[model samples]
Structure formats: structure tokens, C-alpha cells
Target: MERILLQLSYNGADFQGFQIQNEGRTVQYELERILKRMHKDFIRIHPSSRTDKGVHALMQYVHFDTTLSLPTNKWQHAFNSALPDDIYINEVTKINADFHSRYDCVGKAYRYKVYKAPHRDVLKRGIETHITETLDTRKMNEAAQYFIGTHDFTSFCSAKTEIENKERTMYKFEVIETDTGYEFFVIGSGFLYNMVRIMVHFLMDVGRGKRQGSEIPAIIAASDRTKAGKTAPAEGLYLEKIYLSPEELTQDIPKGTTITLKPTRRQLTQQS
Candidate 1:
């Protein structure tokens, strides 16, 4: 038997979520359906993280075990051939049987996109969240600093979340500018359900003059979810990357994943 790790990307627009449910399509179900056909048996896959419905994943990771022998290089092609266009197997690696995709994950990064336009760009409807008001990025950045350290994030988590331990280490949280919008990048040891989105919404409130950057500490101390503002739209959220190596989880983000802003294709075309 061998354990195989696969890196994938998916547009979560149609998925109920990464996890299997009583109804609706899911990333796991689609991939496993393809796997069962290939192995002639059910193959369970363990994903590193579960994203909300309508959220996207740019570099998600999953691992599975199988006794059926198959070339590591051939795995990607086999799966992609049958999977829907929204889901694609990017790379596959044969890992030791003991390796786990979820437990072994050391860190993760997420990007929440916002398009600050008066009218919604229908093309980006499912890709970016639209906002009509102007924002003070300077104040937003100042608010972001409050989230960049170890803290009990009870106030920022969803009421539906079952996890009791609300403390999570936020290694990095910053607002990056794009020509048409803003991308809120957050790297953390882990997050409670809806934590990142709630945090981002609070920062946005600061930007819009509804709240002050200085209020974050008190809000956090309260540990009340209502204090954090609304959760950001799932469609605008992307699970950017999962970091399993120790280097990426350090208090300071590594060189390769340096927290720098780069204009996206939409921004680039507008600039040109």
C-alpha cells in the first residue's frame, strides 16, 4: 500500500463544500468518484482544510491510500481526464504511508478579494466581492495589525463553529492593493470557522469610518462574535496555499511567500 499526496485547485462555485454532505456536489465526491472507477474500489481522500461553499481554492492538498499500483506521474492525468473543468489535479506525489495531509499541515494562507466599484462587474460576480463605498486603506492596514499575533479569536468566529478553543496564531494579516480592488491576505497557524472573513470585515469597517482601528483590542477582549461585523462573502475568498513545511509557518512569512502585493490580470489589463 502507498500514500499519495495530490495538490489541486477548484472553483467552489458549484460545490456544497469540500466535505461530503447529504446532498449537492462536492470536491471530495467528484475526485473520489474518479478514483473509485480507476481503483475498482472506494478510495477515501483526506483534505488539508475545508473551504466554505462558493469559496475557491488555488492550491489545496489532499492525500489518500491505495493498494492499487499506479505511477505517481500518471495520477494527475488520470484524475483530470474525468474530473469536471472546475476541479483539476495539478500534481501528485507518492508519500510515506504515515504522512497525513491535514495533520501535517503547518500553516495556510487565504486571500479575500474585494472589487471597489460603483457597479458590480458581472464577469467577476463569483470571483470578487463588490463594494461601492470608498475606503481608507491606511486605517484598514492599521486595523490589520491587531490581528497579527497570537490571540483568542472568539469574537471573530462564527456562532455555528463547534471548536471550543478559539485561540489561533495569526502570523500575517495585511491589505494589498490592486488597481480595481483590495486583496486581504491572511496567514495563520489555523482559523476558526469564518474567522478570517469576520476579521476582514472588521478591518473594512475601519476603512469605511464605521469603526476605529484602535477598537480592535477591546473587541477581541469581548470575545463576542457580534462585535466583529459581518462575515465577508465566500465567493471572494480563496484558499491561496497550504504550507506543510516548518519554514512557512514561522512568525515571519518565508521569502518565497513574501507578503508583497502584485496586480492581478484584471489590474494589469487596466493599467496597460
Candidate 2:
């Protein structure tokens, strides 16, 4: 058997989440079902991250072992032919047996889209969060700067989260304004359950003048969940990218494939 990695994207409005559940449809379940039909056996996949319900992904990663030896480029086409419309495989590559999609990831970036128009966009329903109130992106950016460092994120996580260690490093956090709304982007070493949503909620409070930008440090230091703002709805969140070491990702890469490593701040600015 050869280990294979797949890069894919999905719209999560209809699925329960990325993982399999006993009672609901999920991305993993659908992907595995298609694989089983194609390979004529049970096939399991390991995803890089577990996204909550209604959370979308632009560049999710997964790895699985398969006996079939289809050409790498053809693998994406073959998988997309059988997979549901909401989920699409973008690329496939062979990898070393030891390569892992989750553990090997060094960083991840997530984006939260907030629609601040007087009326909601009918086309964006179930995809973007609608807020009727105007949001101050400058204040939100100021508040977000406090999150850019290593700290215990207990206050920003869900109460139901079971992880004992809440410390994680935030490498980048920024709020950018668009014509109709705001975009909150966060890149971190790791994140606790609901951490990004809570952070966004806090930034919203700051933007609405309910909280001060300077108050963020104390709130983070408090480590009390009650001190944090409410969790933002999952529909607005998207897993934008996952970062892996160049060496780990280059193994057995397909010819003609161009991998773009994690972008620097300048690159992001240029793209913006």
C-alpha cells in the first residue's frame, strides 16, 4: 500500500462537521464512502483538523493508504467524479509512509467573514454571518493585536473543551475591512476549541464600543471563560490554510506541481 495525501475544499453548510458521526452526514463519512465504492473495501482517512458544524475549508488536508496506483493528477479527477458537489478534491500526491496530515502541520490560518450591511445578502446565506450594526475595523484590529503571542487561551475556548493545556501561540491576527463587512484572519501555532470564534466575538465587542482595545490583555490573563465574549457563529469561519515544513511536503511530490509555502506578511499584503 502507498500513502497518499489529498488537498481539498468544501462548503460545510449541509454537513455536520468534518469528522464522522453516528447520527449525521459529514465530510469524512462522504469521502470514505466514495473511497470504499471505488476501492471495493473499507477505507479510512485522517484529516488535518476537525472543523465544527457549518465551518468551511479552503485548503483542508487528509492522508490515507491505498493500494491503487492511479496517476497523481488523475486521482483528483477520479475522486471528484464520485464525491458530492460541496466537497471537491483539488490535488493528490504520493507521500512517505510516515507522513501525517495532522501531526506534521506546524501552523494553521482561519478567516471569519462578517457581513455588516443593513440587509443580508441572500446569496451568502448560510455562508457568511450577517450583522446589521456597523463594525469599527480599526478598533477590532487594535484589540486583535493583544492576541498575537503565546498565552493560555482558556478564556477564549469553549467550556466543553477537554484539553488541559490551553496555551497556544498566535503568530498573526488582523481585521481588514471590505465594502460590505470585515474579514478577520488569524494564524496560530494551534488553537483550542472555539478559540477563534471567541476571539472574534471579543473583537466585535470592541468594534461596537462595548469593550476597550486595551482590555484584551487582562481578559486573556484572567483565564476565565465568563470574561470572554460569546462565541461567533460557525458559518462565518473558514479554515484558510495549513502550514507544513517544505521538506515534509516535498516528498514524492508530483511533477509540474507548484507548492506555495506559507505566505509572508508582504505577500499577504500584495494579495490583498
Give candidate 1's total backbone clashes.
0
- Cα deviation at 9, candidate 2, in Å, is 0.4
Model 1 lDDT tens row, 139-189? 898889888777899989998889887887777788988899888998987
Please list the residue runs of candidate 1 whose C-alpha ends up more than 4 Å from where it truly belongs after superposition: 251-272
Q: Which of the numbered candidates is closest to the native, going by highest TM-score?
A: 1
| Candidate 2 TM-score over all chains jointly | 0.89
lDDT of 2 by residue, 1-272 (tens): 87888989999999899998887889999889988988999999999899989999999999899998877877888889888899999878787777778877767889999988778889998799999998888889988989987889998999899989888877778999998789999887778999999999999999999999898889888989999979999999999987766443334233443444333221101100
State each model's CA lDDT, in order: 0.83, 0.84
Clashing pairs in 1: none
Cα lDDT of candidate 1 equals 0.83
Per-candidate TM equals 0.91, 0.89
